[model samples]
Target: MKKTILILLLHSSLSWAQMQPFPLQEVKLTAGVFKNAQEVDLKYMLALNPDKLLAPYLIDSDLPLKAERYGNWESSGLDGHIGGHYLSALAMMYASTGNPEMKSRLEYMVSELARCQAKNGNGYVGGIPNGKVFWERIHKGDIDGSTFGLNNTWVPLYNIHKLFAGLRDAYQIAGNQEAKNILIGLGDWFLELIKPLSNEQVQQVLRTEHGGMNEVFADLYIITNESKYLAAAQRLSHQSILKPLLAKEDKLTGLHANTQIPKVIGFEKIAKLTNNADWSGAAQYFWQNVTQTRSVAFGGNSFREHFNPIDDFNKMLVSNQGPETCNSFNMLRLSMALFLDKNDVSYLDFYERTLYNHILSSQHPEKGGFVYFTPIRPNHYRVYSQPETSMWCCVGSGLENHTKYGELIYSHTHNDVFVNLFIPSELNWQEKGIQIIQNTNFPYINTTELVMKLPKNQSFSLNIRYPKWAESAKVTVNGKIQKINKKPSEYISLDRKWRNGDKISIEFGMKTRLEYLPDGSNWAAFVRGPIVLAAKTSTEDLRGLFADDSRMGHETKGKLFPINKAYALVDESGNYLSKLKPIDNLNFTLDSLHLQPFFDLHDARYQMYFQTFTKEEYEKQKDIQKQTEEALMALEARTVDKINCGEQQPEVDHNYIGEQSNSGYDEEQFWRNTRSFISYQLLNKDQRGTYIEISSLDDFKTENLEITINGISIEVFSNNSKTIRLKLPKAEQISLKIRVMSNYTTPRFTEIRIISNE
Candidate 1:
């Protein structure tokens, strides 16, 4: 029966003529950086207590508790999210390495979840806090959602989507039949829950970050050959996001980056399964815009969790938030889906770049902690999560990022094999009766050799990618060079009969180049092949290197170093590459700095981007930058507590709650406005702050708004000024509220700061 089910899945998967990635069980990671990362991730996964992760599910099901729920995000509104990610990581790791511990843990988790579902009595199982009540509200059409919350709960749909994805991965990747049953049960529950809602109401619910609901439902349809699951997938795909992409419009600016990327992945999945050309085109357009116009050299996008203006990346360069790990995690997923669907080698370029630079560098090599942010602001550091304390969204994605490095190393069709990345690995293509051993020390060594071991002579094509960054790529068979000229972003196919001892080798030359920001800014990053290079600047003042359980512990809270103090390339000859002297194949020396692969640099402040200028422009630019940095530092010294109004993490950290409120970005600043009321609770830190300041992007009429402190009305000192300052009460914690006096919406508040008079 198991073999029959596998055959059926394979038949259904080939309904579309797309490249398919080999199962993780077939591609084994050899000795390399990726293998080391996998081992480290496994250790971190073992460090987490399963009972703590399962506590919320048990509590929701009214089962006897074995352990307390984990703190941080687990105890916070987003309870049980990491447990879902843990399920995926365990399944993939078990498939990749066949580790007995991983399989045992996976089976344990699935069984416990099965128990939870049975106890719920409605085929429902989730770790979301008060999930029963939350879904009931949605079932009754009592929907209210923002960018990160739904029905007064913190992204309960997104939280539950993780479980759905986990169960799907468990069944599909690890061959757990029980997990599949649970997934279908949950899917049916969701289908019935939204049966009474209108299309408009579903779209309203999609406003929150719900992960890839459409993609999971589509997987369910593929698994069961059911029509309802397909319809549910279509209904869950947010039309507001899809319409703009379908029309080839980039309405992505100012939107949350990670939330939209997963939806596009779902778009590609549905397009492939149903053969929808328009949706396929929309997904392609989105991938092009994000990769070509919005991404940094490291292949990560966004600033402060929102997509910044494509024409200007200055805000991203200056802010400590930089590109988030979750954005890159989802981008890689979208890239892989598009690459398989279109057989495009260009998509592999981004997948390889992000895998090497961002994903590989996100985890600590020895400490086994996961990074939330990879800051590009020169001299700024990143904070990694502790297994027991940290539970951020990035932590959830980071846990799975390193466990699946073997996913896209190679892809294939019926009679052809495609080498997508240069990572060292061994592939056993069971259906094709072939085994290939790929050996390389890639990025450090510029050549990879593959040896074929087959039962007999086989006639098939071996397609190897010619990377966009590799110059003068060469392919050789059994030490004999083959003349096949191809440009970058294309594949060179070797079509012939292959024997047991046949060998194929690929060699390429890498040249260092200065890649400027996508915004065409003066700032530049160093890249050689697909590897991003950086220099460690300082070891001092690396505060919060390992995160605690605090709400904002994932962010680097150290003092910001002045931008003018960072190293720059000031050359009058318009030749910046001349400054870099090669120390070795993967290391370089630039004046007093030693640069190496970004994945190798850790535990210190580093600079990935450096400002470039001519000799004549350096001094003047330095002075301007110094003044701006000084003013920003002074404000930090005066601020007791502050919140960026429309940003997701900041608002969520401050316990934001509102009704009839909306948030957006304008003039490169985030703002929130409301017709009803919006409130946030901020800390004053020992009653040192005497004044509360509210700043808006637009002028506001004082007569049309009511400002309150702790439910007490406060007088605004400025009538129509962009800045409003009011006296604060003598309390350490202040509840700030802004409401419209009549029917008019309040001004777009950009920031709220607690000020100290001293």
Candidate 2:
């Protein structure tokens, strides 16, 4: 046994990794009120209590919305995602909160799903239409799964992956006995499903998209003590993708970096769980490659939410479109696995960067919408979901996002609670009779105060995370400065007997700097302490393809065309508006284009890194391009908006009555199948400097109507309605506006034109 173990370690660095026995026993947190909120959150989800639509789910056997709204799942590929998420949410909620009801709900779901599978008369059961067929073809290896396909086609394995994952999490996290049984049966079914395919075919299918099935299956195998399950999980591995990562190759350019990384992560966990020394080393190698070599200043990968080529960082810097929030989320998950094995601070460092910059920023402030992509260019806007419509994978992760604030708040070994993420929250450890209250705004403010209350005196080391971003830090014990043994971005140890009412105060100083791309290009990115700095845009100068919904993707001309009114010119020193520090009396939005912490910039146009230039030099460059008809071939910038900094993008003139409900607004009128209607009251209106956009595409969807005063109908979407002519009566207060009624539902207003004869 010793010689065999020695050989395994010799083949890979994973010999250094923790080789724990099968079935990790559950551990209790020493002391804290941390688990309470997770319980409340998980219970709320299990209750199917939706706060957004203000509707409680009818406990009816058939989910009416699932049955009616997305019946048959014939075309839409989103059902499995929703169902998978719902199940995973239940599982995680149960595990984290230890709620019995959650476990019951999960068990119930497994039984219901099993019935559905039985009715299908095969080992196939997909909530969506034709998904079973997709899987069948996937088994045949006819299509590549990872290539972002169009139409009703997608990597079916990826979709089913969520369901399998949810089921597994139900067993592991929530301890649902039924879930385990169902998973074992399902695993058996999967073994038969792939038995007919050749190894090459299986490998090809694995190359496409499939969530962490390989990892989850490996876990299931361990629990069942079955080698077949392990073999199946190994077959699911995409050797092509894993080999490069394991070899420490930077072959990530032009790839769906985020989509692939999670699978590799699953592979990593699978390796660790199965005690594969090579697999574990390979997983770690891939993660380190991404963390040290492939990441941007924000600790994120991918330019357009996919990794560009390894050496082409210069190209990626300019084309940074959508950094996949899902990828970073998975990386953090991967980081935790590594931390558990090695207890290394480096893993936590990456975790901290991603948690603060990506995960925290992924949530929308107005609504708890999770983002799919985070745009790093000044002209691009951060888009978000409106809760129900946007439950992408990020949304699934989003459900888990805020609830586990305690996970990062504390990690325990034999004798310590290693505090990682700093947030304003509380932790109560019932077993230890210890309560810790952490209070502070955090990144917004550098000071975080931890107050620990103990029912009895106890001794333990409080390992506080000295984040990698902090240049220097100080610790104060009960208002007195204490000597910290570790450096910034390292763990500061405090081992002592703690009494009640002991307060620890920490001040971390984070500074900003410029980071250049790997290609030695002149392009650079900004980093303030551990947080990446982005150029904030006040408003978007939406060119074409601008939609009313902020969550919808905007189609712009390209990256070279700047968003008008959103940006300010920076000087040679990279200061806004030629070295203008925001005046104390100036508006908060003046810093609108100022450097923002990366995650605070959801749904706004921001430049995380910039192509710097001075006014004189930039003008000279522009002049050379203008004069040289045969110079650099053609100009890199678009003609419409080469540069429109420090000005508001011209608003598309909008028209509407002050009081629509009091006038002609009808609640009975249906929009988007909803009974909601406009509720504005008519009043005296001004039409100065107000402009309505007129472009060529308006000819087809035009609504030509004669102008009216109080009961007016004006042509809005007409190409012929040049100025959006509207008639406003000279009465005491006659409201004037153009109201759009969509043929489908919900009124679409282009511009609200108001004219007053004052």
TM-scores for all candidates: the values are: 0.97, 0.69
User: Taking the tens digit of each residue's C-alpha lDDT, what string does model 2 give over 3-94?
Assistant: 12222211223232222211212222222222333443443354342211111111111223433332122123444555666677776665
TM-score of 1: 0.97
- Point out where model 2 deviates above 4 Å: 1-66, 69-75, 93-108, 121-124, 131-152, 313-320, 429-434, 517-519, 541-560, 563-592, 614-758
C-alpha lDDT of residue 709 in model 1 = 92
> lDDT of all the models against the reference?
0.89, 0.55
Across residues 129-229, which tens digit of lDDT does each residue of candidate 1 receive?
Answer: 88888889899999878787775588888899999999999999999999999999999999889999999999999999999999999899889888788
In order, how many clashes per candidate? 0, 39
True-structure lDDT of candidate 1: 0.89
- Candidate 1 clashes: the total is 0
What 10-residue stretch in candidate 1 is worst by lDDT?
1-10
